[model samples]
Target: MRKTSLDVTAARVSPALPRRIPRLPGRFPRRLPVRQVLCLLPLALVAVVAVQHWTVLTEGFGKLGTGEWPWLLAAATTTCLAWVAAAVTRQGAVVERMPVFRLLATQFAAGAANHLLPTGLGASAVNLRFMTVCGIPLARSSAALALYILAEAISRVTLLIALLLAFPSALRLSTLLPEGAVGPLLLAVAVATVVAAAVLLLVRRLRTAAVSFLRTALGEARSVHTRPARALALWGGSLAFPALQAAGLVAVGQALGLQIPAAHMAVAYLAATVAVALVPTPGGLGSVEAALIVTLVAAGGDAAVATAVVLTYRIITVWLPLLPGALTLGVLVRLKVI
Candidate 1:
């Protein structure tokens, strides 16, 4: 009886025991959590504006006409082209070999994520995941991203220098305020704030580990530096693509019946856009609209025209992208790609 009971007990417990799960043959996957460190004020700003200027938003939408459509298309096309160039530029630094289609999808998904989410977390997450999925080790992935970012900065600074040289008046902050000593002080404050923020970003090593990782993957940092000329050329091309985009915005303004100068629009658009980027808002919604309108007005545009031009531009460049971007993000989540 005892032997029989032992056998039955063993059988019952053995059948219920959990099996040993096979371990994945890799370093543990790292999750990049999306943190909304910035953009906390955008919601409140949007709400305040909604309550204060509901009439304008409504009226602005009504003014949207067929004539303005082509400019929107131009803006969208140039923006897409800029992104494509950026992705292609990044391809040289990535350690993992991925198909061009995969790279394109990753770029599209990253852009979608960046626009829809706060603080660029979505795009960053997407980028990391794409690198990981393509069999690049996490460290190398980070390094590749770093190199790509450095290239991007070189390009952006070049574009900014060109704009400043082309339109020195656009850099004048005194025009925005009453011409007192206070104007210079305010201008100094603005310049200092921008410089401080940029320094912080550029100095944050963790934010740009991708380049180091790429260096490691290549066996040495010197190996990565060997193609400096090619890298510079790629970066220059990226810069020009975005300059074309700035031109596209001017075209959009013209389409809206606003006779804005291209050089002035480029400078104002870059400044206002940079200010909006600092707001940390998803798509930089209210802050962007306000900055663009104010900048345009300061650049010799009538308030009504500025309002109309900005609204139409935002509709095409910002809101129009949100829905599709959100949908793409959802698809990425489903596919476990990001």
Candidate 2:
């Protein structure tokens, strides 16, 4: 069939019309920035947790009404100081001085991040980014992070041991494990170590990375120790961090009228924390609550009182500051401080 000029023109242009016409900017909404979304995610999660735990949280807050106000206030103060101790330890890990205000803010944000990420990954990531932005090299920043972690672990263990020795009768070591569990536990650890070693030996890249990391970590550790002030800050802050945390628990216990001795409560806090250290939950959430309750009960606290104290402590240290910490994290991210 013969086609009109208009028909021919329409046919020629129709296919290309869709392609030629630009997409209207207003037709589709722009996706939110990844950074903003990420910043909001933790806050959203915090809100979820608060909602889910509303009953427990309300009960915890209610318990505070009957608590010794002074002791509860002291607990809150100690919890706040734990963040300062963390910042000090971060400073001690590197030779270069970080901006004090930023460093402190980063630590505060890190505490919030800790709740969102597993095994303290959030805090580590934040601090590492902060250090890198402050002009520290990546390797050194990683090494500094390692040093901080090692120092913190050692200090926690050391404090635990000291408390145990000082109060031998406080925590019953024998009751912590079943009669025959130790042998199997040790065997399992040995097997795991051997397997890990074999895997590293078989993987050249993994071995190389491990060796390099160890060398850098060792070198950084030595360098940090050379400066007496840095060494003091690192070790002292590490020591104080866990001590203050345990003290906060103790203070909470006292406020809540937990009948357990303060020393026993301190030991319970350390032991419970150490037991659940490898659980990999964010800020040891569920694991921490369970361990604290169990350990406190084992340490001769009344179960009801122990639960109340733990709830109050978590409310004070974790939930209460959560929103503020999340806001601080958002601010730091916006500012590119972390």
Candidate 3:
């Protein structure tokens, strides 16, 4: 297939940004250059997060001042380190060893990008671009992305199950259930899965592409697992990323005096996130807060306190990182580091 302009532009690996920009004839430097816009878009979207949550940000600052300082500090610390965990997992996704600092930077930038784009499209695009800039082939880069996602999903579910089993009796799991809702919900989910599977199998082109993509992804997964260090990093980082996120939530819960056990809080966090994982909101924005608050309240926390905990957790994790992460993203793009 002939390469499109984007393919050609992306193929050029250089220290400077790719010249995919179009110049207007007799232009006065084109008031807003494409490159500037490209870099600014992520920043703008990220800044919108803070703007939308200005009340929460202000309230959160006041809470942090009055709330338990140590726990809030711990929450902030874990949130920052989640990016490092993500970077490690990204490294493990492919056989090639990316520059550590750049990879770390990319993950941080990806976080900012993830805020506005639904279902993680922003982060995925940024990471895919970074892989291409690092000279990885498009197919391999795609496979690597698939592997990272697969690992993350598996690890999250695994951790959730483990935690639930360990504290099953204490978690008041029944409170969250709408009495007979489980059976119907399960049936609905199963029906949807069946429908999706049927569609994939019935459509020849879709089936063929799906099979090919699976083959590539599986081959990449096998390759990654063969290296012990890589395998450890992949699985370890995947587990750590969500675990840290849950820990951050737990710390916030403690800081806000949420009347729930730490183990129960962790279980609630994981359960809420897993339940809303498929919701097509950016970083599970609205869905996550609603689900988490519900889960915490079901797990014996006061409703108002649960609301406070969830909002504060998001303020610390998402809002706090937006600006710096956006700056990092802009810098990475300006340096052609993707």
The C-alpha lDDT values of all candidates are 0.66, 0.91, 0.89
Error of 2 at 234 (Å): 0.5
TM-score of 1: 0.68
Tens-digit per-residue lDDT, 162-243, candidate 3: 9888898546767778789999999999999999999999999999999998998999999999999999999999999999
TM-score on alpha carbons, each prediction? 0.68, 0.90, 0.88
Better of 2 and 3 by TM-score: 2
lDDT of 3: 0.89
Estimate the overall C-alpha local distance difference test score of candidate 1. 0.66
Q: Lowest summed-lDDT stretch of 10 residues in model 3?
A: 10-19
Give per-residue CA lDDT, model 1, range 1-338, as digits (tens).
35798798999899778788666767677554443212222334335535555665566566556446776678778777766775766565653346676677677766656655675566677887888887877777766776666666566666767887878776456655566878686899899999976775788684365445545755523444567754543565557655765776787787777766778888778767655655786656577789888888777777888788888776655545544555555565556565
What digit string (tens of lDDT, one per residue) describes model 2 on residues 6-69?
A: 9999999988776676779899888899888867877898887778778878998888788899
Pairs that collide, model 2: none
- Using TM-score as the measure, name the better of candidate 1 and candidate 3: 3
lDDT of 1 at 232: 48
Off by over 4 Å in 1: 1-61, 170-172, 177-225, 228-234
Q: Single out the weakest 10-residue window by summed lDDT for candidate 1.
A: 34-43
lDDT of 1 at 313: 72
Number of the top lDDT candidate = 2
